[model samples]
Target: MRVLVAGATGVVGRALLPLLTSVGHEVTALSRTPRQGTVVADALDRSALHRAVREAAPDAVVHLLTAIPAEVNPRRLARDFALTNRLRTEGTRNLYEAARDAGATKVVAQGLAYAYDPEGEGPATEDAPLWRRPPRQFAPVLAALRELEERTTDAGGTVLRLGHLYGPGSSYAADGSFVRQVRAGKVPLVGGGGSVFSFTHAHDAATAVVAALDKPHTGPLNIVDDTPVPLRDWLPELARMLDAPAPKAAPAVLARMAVGGWGVAFMSKLRGADNARARLSLDWRPRYPVWREGFAAELNGTSDGTQG
Candidate 1:
C-alpha cells in the first residue's frame, strides 16, 4: 500500500517511516521542507495539505501532528498543548478532507487512551464514554479527541487511541522534560496517586499503527501495553529507575494549588485503557507488554533513546 504521513518529523512519524518501508509499503513523508520525493505541507494549512495529498496520491494517510512543549513547566505545557488541541481538532479535519480528495480510503490518526471516563473500573474499554464533563478546563482536550475520532470514522478511517507513549523520543526519554523534572524532584505524587495510566513503547506504537493499516477498522481502538498501573506504583518506580528522590506527596488542597484543578484531576482520575480490541483487530501485541521493561530500558540506557 502507498501511505502518506503528515508530521513526518514527529516522534512517531520518524519511527513509522522506516517501519512501513521495512514492510514493503511505499511511504511518502509530508514535511514543511520538501526533500527528494517527499511531500511538503503544513498540516494546519488546509490548501497545502490537500495539494500534497493530491500529489502524493497515496492509498492511506497518516496524521501524526503534535506541538508539545520542550520544557515540562506547567505554564508552558498548558500553552503548548492548546496548540496540540488545535492540531487534533482543526488539523484532523484538514487531513481527512485532503485524504478524501486524494482518493485515500483509509486515514489513520492518533488519539489518547487516557481520555476515557474515570468512573470505570479496571482499564476502560473502547466503548467507555470519554469524559464528557471533564474537570472544567479538561473538557476541550477530551472534546478535541472526540472530534478527531468522529472525523476519522466519518471518513471511513481508523483511530488508534494510544496510551501514554514512553520509551525513546517521548516524555519518558532520557533527555525528555519528564525525566529532567523527576530527577530534580519537581513532579509530586498527588492525592494518593491512585489514578491509573496505560503506557506504550514508541516502537511498539508504530508497529501497532502498521498492524492497523491493513485491518478494517472504523472506530476507536485502544493500543496499550498489557499492564495498566497507577501513579502510586509507576511514579516511585520511575524515580527509582532515575536514581532520584521519590516524588513528594501532596494533599488534595496542595495538589490542586500546585498543578491546578486539571492537573490534580489528571493524576487523580485519568484511567488506563484496555487493549483487547486492538490485539484482536490489529493482530498485534506490544513489543514491551509491560511499561516497566520499556521504562527501565530507556532509563538504564539499554534502548538507544532513538526511533520513537
Candidate 2:
C-alpha cells in the first residue's frame, strides 16, 4: 500500500511513519518543517496539501495534525483548544480534500474518545452521542469532532477515536508537566475521583492507526486499551511509580476552584471508551493492555518490544 501521513512529526505520527515502512508499505510523510523524504506543506492549506498528496499519489492518507500547546494552563483549556479545534474541523476538511484529489481510497483520521456525553455508565462505544449541548466552552471541540467524523465517514474513510494519549511526547510522560505537578503535589484528587479513562501509549496508538489503514471501515472505532481505570486508581499509582507526593483530596467546590470546572469535569465525570470494534475488526490489541503496567514501563524507559 502507498500511504500519505500528515503531521508526520507529531507523537503518534512519529511512531506510525516508521511502523508503516517496516511493514513494507510505501510511505509519504508530510511535515510543516522540511525533512528528508517528507512532503512540506501546511496541513490546513487545502491547495498545498492537495498538491503534496497528488504528487505522492498515495492510496491512503492518515490525518494526525493537532496544535495543542506545550504549556497547559488548566484554567484555559477552552482558550487553548481554540486553535486545535480549528485544526480538527478545518484541517480535517483540507486533508480529506487532499485525499480525494489524490484519489486515495482509504483515510484514517484522528479523533477523541473523551468527547462522549458523561451521563451514561460503563465504557462508551461509537454509538454514544457526543456532548452536543454544552456550556458553549466545550462546544467547539465537540462540533469539530462531529464534523471530522461525518466528513471522514461520508468520504468512505475510517475514524480512530483515541483515548487520552500518554507515553513519550505527551503531558503524562515522565518528564512532562503533569508528572512534575504530581511530584510537587499540585494536582489534587477532585471529590471522589470517579472519572474513568482508557489510556493509549503513543506506540500502541500508532499501531492502531496503521491497523485502521489496513481495515476497511466508514465508521468511528475506539482505539483504546482493555482496562478502563478511574482517576483515583491511576493517580495514586502514577504518583507511587514516580516516587512523587500522594495527591491530596479536594472537595468538589474546592477542586473546581483550583483546576476550574472543566478540569474538575475531566477528573470526576469523563467516561472511558471501549475498543472492541478495533480489536475484532483490525485484528489488533494494545501493546500495553493496561496502563498500570504501561506507566512503569514508559517511566522506567523499558519496552517488551511487543505490539501487545
Candidate 3:
C-alpha cells in the first residue's frame, strides 16, 4: 500500500513513516516546508493540500496535523489550542476531501479520548457523548474535535481518539513543560483530583494508525492504554520520578482562580477513555500497557523518547 502522511514531522508522524515501511508499505510525507522528497503543503491551505495529495496519489491517508504549543497556559486553554483546533476542523476537511479526490481507499485521522463528558462512569467508550457544556476556554476545542470526527466519518474514515499523549516530543517528556511545572511544584491536585486519565505513548499512537489502515474499522476508535489513573495517583508519582517535591493539594475555588475553570475541570472532572473497541477491532495493544513503565523509561533515560 502507498500511504501519504500529513504532519510527517510531528512526534507520531516521525515514528509512523518507519513503521509503515517496515510493514511493506511505501510512505510519502506531506509537510508545510520543503524536505528531501516530502509533498510540501499545509493542510489548512486547500489548494496546496489538494495538489500535494493528488501528487502523492496514495492508497491511504493519515492526518496527524497539530500545532499545540510546548508551553500551554491553562488559564488560556482555548488560545493555546487555537491553531490545533483549526488543524482538526478545517485542516481535517481539506485532507479528507483531497484524499477522496486522490482515490485513497482508507483515511485515518486523530481525535481525543479524554474529551468525554464528565457526567458518569469508569472509562468512556467510543460512543460516549463529548462534553456538551464545557468550560468557556475548552468549548471551541471540543467543537473542532467534533467537526473533525464527523467529517472523517462522513468520508468513511477511521478516527483514532487517542488518550493524553506522553512520550518523546510530548508535553510530558522529561524536559517538557509539564515536567518543568511538576519540578517547580506548580502542578497541584485540585478538588482531590478525582478526574481520570488515560495515557498513550507516541509510538503506540503511531502503531494504531498502522493498524487502522489494515483494518476495516471506520468511525471513532478509542486508542489508549489498559489502566485509567487519576491525577491524584499519577501526579505524585510523576513528581517522585523527577525527584521533585510532591504536588500540593489546592482547593477547587482557589485553583479555579489560578488556572481558570477549564484547568479545574481538567484536573478534577475529566474522564478517561476505554480502548476495548480498538483492541478487538484492530487486534492492537499498547506496547507500554501502563503509564508507569513508559514514563519511567522515558524520564530515566532508558528510552530516547522517540516514538520508535
Candidate 4:
C-alpha cells in the first residue's frame, strides 16, 4: 500500500512514518519543512495540498496535521486553541477535499478523546455527547472538532479519536517542550486534581493509524489505551517517573485565575473514554495500556527501541 502522511514531522506522524515504511508500504510524508523524502504541503492551502496529494497519488492519506503546539506549553493553549480550531476545521476540510479529488481509498485522521464534558459517565464511549457547549473560551475548539469529524467521515473516511498523547514529543514528558514547565514546578495542579483522562503512547497511536488504513470500518472510533488515569494519580506517578517533585496543588479558584477557564477544566475535571470499539474493529491493542507503564518506559527512553 502507498500512504501519504500529512504532518509527517509531528509527534505521532514521525513515529507512524517509519512504522508504515518498515511494514513495506510506500510512504510519502508531507510537511511544511521537507526532509529527505518528505513533500512540502501546507494543509490550509487547498490548491497546494491538492496538487501534492495528486502528485503522491496515494492509496491512503493520513491527516495527522495539528495546529496545537506541543504539550509542553499548556499555559499558551488558550491563545493557540483558535489556531488549532482552524487546523481542525478548514485544514481538515482541505485535506478531505484533496483526498477525495485524488481518488484516495482511505482517509485516516486524528481527533481528541478528551474534549467531551465530564458531566456524564466516567468512561465516555463514541456514542456519548460531546461538550458542544464548552466554556466561551473553548467554544471554537469544540466547534472545529465537530466540523472536522463531520467533514472527514461524511465521505466514508475514518476518524481516530485519540487519547491525551504522552509519549515522546508530546506534552506529557518532563523534557517535552510544553510540559517541561510543569517539571520545573511552574505549572501547578488545579483544585483537588481529580480529573480523569485516557492516554496513549505516540508510537501506539501511530500504530493504530497504520492499522486503520486497511481496516474496513468507518465513522468515529476511540483509539485509546485500555485504562484511564485520574489526574491526582497521574501527576504523582509522572513526577516519580521523571524524577521530579510532585506538582503542587492549587485552589481551583487560584488556578482559574492563573490559567483561565480551559486550564481549570482540564486540571480538575473528570472525563474518560472507552476504546473497545477500536479494539474490536481494528484488531489492534495499545502497547501501553495506561500512563504508568508507558510513561515509565518513555521516561526511561525505551520507546525509541520499541517502535512496534
Q: Which candidate is the best by TM-score?
A: 3
Q: In model 1, which residue pairs have backbone atoms overlapping below 3 Å? A: none
lDDT of 2 by residue, 1-308 (tens): 99999877777887787788899899989877778878888877888877888888999988888888877665787788888888788888888888887789998888888888988879999898887564345667678788888888898888888898887777887877788889888878897899899898888888988888878777898988899999999999888888889888889898777677777788888889999988998898898899887888878878522243
Query: What residue pairs are clashing in model 4?
Result: 71-171, 71-178, 72-177, 72-178, 72-179, 73-178, 195-269
Candidate 3 residue pairs in backbone clash: none
What is the lDDT ranking, best to worst? 3, 1, 2, 4
Evaluate residue 72 in candidate 2 and report its C-alpha lDDT on the 0 to 100 scale. 68
List per-candidate RMSD values in Å: 1.8, 1.7, 1.2, 1.9
Each model's total of backbone clashes: 0, 2, 0, 7
Error of 3 at 89 (Å): 1.5
lDDT of 4 by residue, 1-308 (tens): 98999877777887888889899999998877767777778888889989888888888988887766554233456467777777787888888788888888888888989888788867999998888667666677778888888987786778899888876667776477645765676656788888887987888888898789889787889888888878888777666666667789899887877777777888887588999999999998999886678877877777762367
lDDT, candidates in the order shown: 0.84, 0.83, 0.90, 0.80
Candidate 4 worst ten-residue window by lDDT: 69-78
lDDT of 3 by residue, 1-308 (tens): 99999988887887788888888998999988888768999898999999999999999999888998888888998999999999998899899889999999999998899999999788999878999899999999999999999998888889999999987788898888888999999899999999999999888999999999998887999989999999999999999989899999999998998899999999999999999999999999998899999899889877653434
Error of 4 at 268 (Å): 1.1
Q: Which residue segments of model 1 deviate by more than 4 Å?
A: 72-78, 304-308
Worst 10-residue lDDT window for candidate 1 reads: 71-80
lDDT of 3: 0.90
